[model samples]
Target: MLSQITPCLWFDGQADEAAKFYTSLFKDGKVTRTQYYGEAGKEIHGQEPGSVLTVEFELNGQNFVAMNGGPLFKFNEAISFQIECEDQEELNHYWQKLSDGGDPAKQQCGWLGDKYGVSWQVVPKVLGGMLSDPDTAKSQRAFTALMGMKKIDIAALKTAYEG
Candidate 1:
């Protein structure tokens, strides 16, 4: 069955490359199919005939399409995929992998922009609860700790929450 909603990512010319890279990172990911550009839209797109047009892939069970849509659009921080990490290890692993070739300047509050310019938030699942705790002091401490870091340190967050 097809997913009711799928995210389509736009790339300048790295649709296939990005798809492969992304799928490699997740255990539940795979490149299911790929499509190429034909001469039909030559005048508008100007891409070489038979070049990659789109790659349909699944990441962590969610279907996504990567399209070589030219430089007309770029990914921004306004929209980001948040990875709710189960623990510090999971959070560290993802943060390291995703931010390897990413711009260092974009790191803030567990949010990072990957090499493809796509924004992602690698946060521990406990973060939400800490931030929403009924005790204002605990929540505020957690918020302060969160605001001070780029990639999250689960220990520090917990300490702040327990304070």
Candidate 2:
């Protein structure tokens, strides 16, 4: 029942589907509600009476609400979910799933996208150490290694920082 902490997402007639897809991506998460507009509600965006208006779900212990907002807006790469992974295995799993349908963009550190146009970062915990390393050279190398990856190669990052 956490309030004031949920992400409200806008979808173009795909709120329900997006909710279902997001729930499937994370453990301990699922769609909790799908509310439809009724005849009493004014027709909006040509939505038929009784059409779904909102979808509520949870992912990775975070609550999300999606609305059929009539294509007024969309998700962009500007805002992203950052997953700090423990190791490369976890990073790969998340990278594969999230990038299944979206375009991949290589950035310094860890970042990518899913087919649904959602941005994500599968960062390794070790990255924090590297970025915070006392040695400026190692930190620069770590930054360079992060820049060369689309899906974060933890081993490469580690090697860069260590060497």
Candidate 3:
């Protein structure tokens, strides 16, 4: 059975590379299939015939597709995948891995842009609870603390929330 929805990532010419990177980073990740460009759409796609065109991959058992769609489009903060970590250790691990070779300037409030131009948010699972507290002061403090850091600091957020 085919999945009803699969996020397709567009890459300039690094579909294979990007797929491999993503799969290697997540548990149960793997390249399920590969597709090559053909002469049929040479005029429309302007891609090298017989070259790598698409890669079907899975991350943590979730299906995803990568297409060599040229540089017509790029990933931005408008659409980002959020990783809700259960603990500070998990958050640190993900943040370190995802931020490797990423743009430091774009890193803020738990948001980071990877080397592939993909934006990802590394968040703590307890963050929502703290930010949505009944007390506005507690929530605002948590938000203020969060806005000042690139990688989320659960301990800092906890301090701010408890204050």
Report the number of the highest-lDDT candidate: 1
Is candidate 2 or 3 superior in TM-score? 3
Candidate order (TM-score): 1, 3, 2
Q: Report the alpha-carbon TM-score of model 1 versus the true structure.
A: 0.96
TM-score of 2: 0.88
Q: Which candidate is the best by TM-score?
A: 1
Off by over 4 Å in 3: 1-3
* lDDT of each residue in 49-129, candidate 3, tens digit only: 899999999887678899999989988888888888899988888788888998898799899998898999989999999
Which candidate do you rate higher for TM-score, 1 or 3? Answer: 1
Candidate 1 collision pairs: none
Computed on alpha carbons, the lDDT of every model, listed in order, comes to 0.95, 0.79, 0.90
TM-score of each: 0.96, 0.88, 0.92
How far off is model 3, as Cα RMSD?
Answer: 1.9
Candidate 2 residue-wise lDDT, 77-129, digit = tens: 78988888888888887777777777745333567766666677888888888
